[model samples]
Target: MTGTCGSCGRDDEDVVLVRRLYVTPEAWDTPGKVEQGDEERWCFVCRTHYPHEELGQA
Candidate 1:
């Protein structure tokens, strides 16, 4: 699979994989809510600048 960096927008072979979670307004109001999301690949530059557990080196 190929994708661009979430930050630098680079689609190089080496990049970071990250997922985004989005919750509906109603879900947010509930005590227990499930989030829907998507995954994205980020460039090495972004991974270096912003490192997080959710972002995996691809």
Candidate 2:
């Protein structure tokens, strides 16, 4: 699927599926690249921003 990456804002066909959990304000009080509880397709570059464990990759 073609869509813009919520992280890098890249509009390309090369993308990977990413999953994130819903966190409350207290959990994400710090300023960082935290996803707001949703699954989205992100490009390879943007995908690298997230942790490998969270991606369910070995």
Candidate 3:
């Protein structure tokens, strides 16, 4: 799918649906509970270089 990456905001043809990038928080409301952020469309390059959980093809 060709679209803008949610991370880098770059146009790419290899964009796919992926979980939002995770950020380390100073404190967690519930420790040990993994919080998966919203899904977003991201280019393959950004997905490979950044921390993201793949959802599927966009």
Q: List TM-score per model, in order.
A: 0.40, 0.46, 0.66
Error of 1 at 15 (Å): 1.3
lDDT (Cα, tens digit) per residue for candidate 2, span 15-53: 666675443344456654434556666677766655422
- Ten residues in sequence with the least summed lDDT for candidate 1: 20-29
In order, what lDDT does every prediction score?
Answer: 0.57, 0.57, 0.77
Q: After superposition, how far is residue 53 of candidate 2 from its true place, in Å?
A: 6.5
Model 1, range 1-58, lDDT digits (tens) per residue? 4566666676654665776554344555566544645666766565556533464655
Runs of candidate 2 with Cα error greater than 4 angstroms are 21-36, 52-58
lDDT string for model 3 (1-58, tens) is 8888888888755788999756665555644435678888888788878777888874
In model 1, where do residues sit more than 4 Å from their true spots?
19-39, 55-58
Best by TM-score: 3
